[model samples]
Target chain A: MEILSSFIKNPRKTTYGGEDNDEKIIFLLRKSVIVNINWVTVAFILLLLPLFVSPPLSKLTYMGMRVINPGFILALNLFWYIFTIGFIFQNFLAWYFDVLMVTNKKVIDIDQSCTDVSETTLSNVQDVSSKVKGTWGVVLDIGDIFIQTSAEQREFEFLDVSNPSKVRDEIADLVAKIKKRNGS
Target chain B: MVPNLPIRQLVIAGKIIVILIMVLYAVFAFILTKRVKLMNANLTTPQSKLFERIARIHMVLSIFVIILATINL
Candidate 1:
């Protein structure tokens, strides 16, 4: 009973905090991954080429009908495997790196990279300007958020998150609350 | 029949192109890794560590590709 109580009382430290918070903890206003669907499509097409070419080459080599070395075929397979793996890894990193989080006190852009860099800016809420751009962007439901500030910084642009309208409304609401609290 | 292209010449040309690309990839990876390191120095986070691991893998693959291309050439 004592062990259970301690465990409940002091939860272990975690790398990422939960979405829901009781003490005025605001949900993450926006999340996005940096993948242009077009680029992914291009990479997929390139990776598929080897699959079509490999089988015939392998068969020819096995039958000893072709002068080509078996080792060359193996090398090609290895190269394709490496290329595919690299492509996936690059895409994953791009997605992981691109994120924007909004809380009651501030807006945080956690740009994931080997070098950890986070940019946090306090919001006025009143100056939030949201814009959705491009035909594909509109169709996909992903666009940029422009947060205009009275400060010297000018503006903060949150790029390529799904459902821009919802994120805008949430930010507007938070800003209203903040203004109401500060009597501004 | 048209004169056949020497297999050796074809392989050598392909190898040169592959090596050039691998070298370019390595250069970009190194620059990216340095940028990541600078960011990590400023802020320590689990996400940063994950990025470092990914960069390391990219670097290793770049080296391997270069070596393989050299061998084939």
Candidate 2:
């Protein structure tokens, strides 16, 4: 359920931040494109490579040590497996938690990599734009969103998000409503 | 001729190094667990509970593995 769960009854669900009075979530987005996990996938491949080449590698270990205990090697393998599993678990959590939330009043971007968060209020928004570049972005329908605001923070970007145009339009519409309400 | 090292001495030394490394990893895992808890408290969002659950499981499993290694290896 990335951004606006159309399937569920309570469609607008966000992982972080609470809704204010009459403030509702428009969408909750994860980083766009499945390619974001390429590094982790490569790591998995590397982890499994030792298994395939163990026969030759074991010979090398025997030559160096002159007495390689099978039991010791088995224990080491178990340790490595556990360590690798923990590494993968942490990476997945980081990917899953990194979120961009669009609410009626504001947009909240949370970067799980460093746990940094930035927000842009609709009242302060001056311009909204989204870009879908590169072959992968065009083919997969994933892109980045940019918001220019009057506040000190100025620009807020939601990087690598899916359906950037739709997100941009939704934010633009909300900003217009806010402007109209203020008689501006 | 290369002098033959005592295999028992070498094995014990390797195990000690492994234990030291595992201890360091255990500390790192504990710190990560605490960080997740802190983030959950600050955000208190709908998915915070889910995140907390996963964090707890990861921390528990990590510690359990360390204990297993300590006892067996």
Candidate 3:
């Protein structure tokens, strides 16, 4: 269709770069699907006890209404519900915003602290150095990628990316190819 | 009976903790903004200033939340 062709011709602009260069990198979600399952399990367990305990407590407090106003207890429950919902939404947005990607020629780091802002860093693949610190990081296969670029005076670090060893290897291979192509 | 002593002591402690957390967050935001400003100076872009403002707002809101929570506690 003509619409599709025009859409392809005029791609959306991104903060990563201009529209023309933005689509070059294939981005990947930082977390695995299993992480959602784990979160769901934890949320369910946390809510289950309160669900069962709250009704009986509410009933008892209602019966003892002469001593204290039931409306106060109801208000407390409303606040608890609001706080829990807000916490869940924050976690979901945090997970959604944390992303990592390997471009053909570089690595991109994206982070979102909350709803309002996002930060990104771009580094050449050749300059990336993989470091796995701490015993837990080594066992879990998650570590930081320290990228020292010639273009930028300071090193840019991508912290706590999963499977850093594999990412490092992939980047090393890509850099070799680029070097070979350039005959450098 | 200790009267309202427990509640008064708890509110004071909460206030102190909230103040300490706010100070720490302010320091963190300052460091991050300084780094962004340095990068922007080299890159010759105004976008870093926008990021610095956003970070400052985040720190302010975080401090506000801690203060509100302490009062309610």
Candidate 4:
């Protein structure tokens, strides 16, 4: 379930504020978890660094005076590890909370700020396009979907979303269905 | 050039600085937990409660570390 959160289709028992009681989320798009590998790797390296770092400092001599106190090392390591944990949590939240979801009624883009939410009705959708860039994106099936709309925001972009073409088609289908229902 | 201060003084100063930084971080962790709660209210997922619990635990962990630093540093 955790792994599936990044790109969930027809999510069950999921809801956002202001949703109608019967409203259903069709696609819940968060940035691909693969994107976090860079920072995760950095955090892993940082966690292991103190072991390699303190030994060299303890052996170092500066003008016949030892450079770093060995006793302070443990506290320093604790500080460093906590800081890294904060870094990991921060990045994870930025990715998790910033969501682009398509529902039966509208498309909502929740920005990284966690407080801002922008949305447009399906009936207002004018165009939908999907693009996959780079080898990794194509291989990993990660891409962006661009939605042209007549609403106030005009465009809603879902970035680093998994399976862009599928989402775009589903959105396009919903828009067409709404247009037919409205006879627009 | 490295200052030739006594090792004990340097350790004490380092501990104080680390504590100050950690205190600021504790404040940030508090803000983060608040924000996480706000987000959960906005978007209630199947995992919302779980994530909210995780955020609170992180906040507590940060405060606990600060206490440990005070005791051990």
Ranking by lDDT: 4, 2, 1, 3
Off by over 4 Å in 1: A1-35, A55-68, A108-125, A132-143, A179-184, B1-6, B35-45
Q: Which candidate is the best by DockQ?
A: 4
DockQ scores for all predicted structures = 0.20, 0.36, 0.05, 0.44
Q: List per-model TM-scores for chain B.
A: 0.74, 0.73, 0.55, 0.87
Model 3, A1-184: lDDT tens digits are 3211101112222224321353344333254333455666766665565677567755652223422234434433443443344344445434544544444445455554422222233433337678877886777776776666555435556666567777666655655676677566
Ranking of all predicted structures according to DockQ, beginning with the best and ending with the worst: 4, 2, 1, 3
Which portions of model 4 miss their true places by more than 4 Å?
Answer: A2-4, A54-75, A182-184, B1-4
- Cα displacement (angstroms), candidate 1, residue B67, comes to 3.0
| Per-residue C-alpha lDDT of model 4 across residues A57-103, encoded as one tens digit per residue | 67866567665555546556766777787788788878888898888
Query: Lowest lDDT 10-mer window, candidate 3 chain B?
Result: B39-48
DockQ of candidate model 3: 0.05
Ranking by TM-score: 4, 2, 1, 3
Which candidate, 1 or 2, has the higher DockQ?
2
lDDT of 1 by residue, B2-67 (tens): 455565556557657766866887787677667656555543344567768777876777677677
Top-lDDT structure, candidate number: 4
Q: Please provide TM-scores, in order, for all candidate models, with all chains considered together.
A: 0.64, 0.78, 0.48, 0.85
Error of 3 at A173 (Å): 1.9
Docking class of 4: acceptable
